[model samples]
Target chain A: MVPIAYYLVLSAVLFSIGVAAFLIKRNIITVFMSIELMLNAVNLAFIAFSRQWSQTTGHLQVNGQIFVFFVMVVAAAEAAVGLAIIIAVFRARNTLNVDQIDLMKL
Target chain B: MHLALFIIFAGLCVAGALNLLLQRHPINSALSLIVVMSSLAVLYLLLGAEFLAAAQVIVYSGAIMVLFTFVIMLLNAGKEERTHGSRLAYIAGFPGAAALLGLLTYIFLSHSATFGQARLGEYLATTDDISRVLFRDLLLPFEVTSVLILIAILGAVALARKEH
Candidate 1:
């Protein structure tokens, strides 16, 4: 049996890694991927907590998994819209570098 | 057995994430993201969310990653060029992330007694069980997601259309 804390710790580490990648990576696509990584980490935590509740209550709890389902749905939607926006950005700016795409930067 | 599996996949997941950061090209990062997603699917299975494990594979690695790869290829994205990023970012970002991880780990470990252990296969959330909740209790949100997907589709099409 793995301690629930182990799963939570893994989630936290992955999330931190995602945050670092989001900050350090200059490519817009890579940054988008980091966002996905963070979402995945949160999903892991949600399932861990769901499992914890189920273990303590002596029954299967579907709520956490259900929320994960919704999260996945929203992620899919986000990816579609985000990639399209990325395409538009690429078409307009002709580059994927975040630093160079600072038209709005003061 | 479960602990060993968990450790292996978790390690793979972290390695894949690090590879995503280390890789210079968007395509390489995309491939590593696939690896991370696949490993995460395995972790979900270990956590006894069988349906989510499958969904994680099919939706994330399959559908979403393919979309990313297609866009990468379509754009002919080149390898990222290194720049002397802002000093404040380098100084604050790495340590900030480490601090966040340490804080989360400390909190989880401190409360481990309450969280307890997660024994594998003790309680499985079958697809049937999940669908019941999704359709009955969470039906409104479920349907709303469908609408959200539709709106996303329209937005993508509208945004990506040629200007000419």
Candidate 2:
């Protein structure tokens, strides 16, 4: 039996890595991928908590998993719209570098 | 057995994430993200969310990643050029991430007893179980997501369409 804490620790580590990647990576697509990574990490935590509740209550609790399902749905929608915007930005600016696409930067 | 499986997949997942960060090319990064997603799907299975494990694989690895790869190829994205980005970002980002991880790890480890242990196969959330909740209890949100998807589709089409 794995301690639920272990799963939570793993999720935290993955999320921190995602945050680092999000901040450090310059490519817009890589940044987008990091966002996905963060979402995945949160989903893992949600499931871990769900399992913990089920273990303590002596029944299966589906709420956490259900939240994860909705998160996935939203993530899918976000990816579609985000990639399209990325494409449009690429077409207009002709580069994917975040630093160079600072038209709105003061 | 379950602990070992969890360690292996978790290690793979972290490695894939690090690879995604280190790789210079977007395509390479995309491939590593696929690796991460696949390992995550395995982790979901270990957590006894069988349906989510399948969905993670089919939706994330199969559908979303393919879309990413297609766009990467379409744009002809190249290896990222190194730039000495703002010094503040470099100084703040890594340490900030480490601090966040340490804080979370400390909290979880210190309070491990509250969370309890998760033995594999003890409590499985079958597809039938999940769908019942989704359709009956969460039916409104479920249907709303369909509308959300439609809006996203329209938005994507509008954004990506060529401007004559």
Candidate 3:
């Protein structure tokens, strides 16, 4: 039997890495990918806790896993709209670098 | 056996994420994210989330990441240019990130006993079980998500179309 806390640690590490990438990366798409990383980390935590709770409660509640499904759906939808916007911005500005796409200048 | 599986896949997932962070090309980063997602699906399977493992692979790696790659190709997003790091970040970022990681690790390790050891095959979430709860209890959100996906598709097409 693996300790649930191990899973928590792994997810936490992944989440922090995602945050670091989000802050340090300059390209918008990489930053976006980091956001996806954070989402996946949260999903991991949800599934881990769902398993833990099911183990303790003996009722087998799958609410957390179901929520993971909803999160995935939202992620897919966000990817579609977000990448489309990125493409549109590239067309208008001819670049995908975040620093270079500063159109909101005073 | 569970420990071995978790260790290997978790290592792969972390390596993939680190690769994603290090890669300058968006395409490479997307590929690394795919690696991370697939490995996470394996982890979900270990946690007895069988259906989520499938959906994570299908939706995230198959659909969402493919979309990212397509946009990267369409945009022809080149390698990111080297940029000078701010002095504050150079001095403080490394220590801050390390401190965050250490704190999280400490918290999880300290609470390990509160969460009992997870036995393999202890609680399997079957597809029927998931469907029952999802369709019965979460029907509204399910329908809303479908609508959201439809709207996203339409919006993507509207935004990505060639401007006359």
Candidate 2, residues B108-139, lDDT tens digits: the string is: 99999999988878899999999999999989
Per-residue lDDT of B1-164 in model 1, one digit per residue for the tens? 98899989999999999999899999999999999999999989888999999999999999999999999999999999987666787899889899999999999999998998988787888999999888888888888889999999999999999999
lDDT for each residue of candidate 3 in A1-106, tens digit (9 for 90 to 100): 7899999889988988897887778888888999999999999999988988987897788989998998998988898888889888888988777777767845
lDDT of 3 by residue, B1-164 (tens): 99999999999999999999899888999999999999999999999999999999899999988888887887778898867545576568767877888998898899888777888886889999999998998899899999999999999999999999
- CAPRI category for model 2: high
Which of candidates 1 and 3 reaches a greater DockQ? Answer: 1
Fnat per candidate: 0.82, 0.81, 0.79
| Residue B95 displacement in candidate 3 (angstroms) | 5.5
lDDT-superior candidate, 1 or 3? 1
**TM-score of decoy 3:** 0.94
Error of 2 at A95 (Å): 0.5
lDDT of 1 at A49: 94
Report the C-alpha displacement of residue A77, candidate 1, in angstroms.
0.5
TM-scores for all predictions: 0.98, 0.98, 0.94
The regions of model 2 sitting more than 4 angstroms off are none
Q: Model 2 reaches what TM-score against the true structure?
A: 0.98
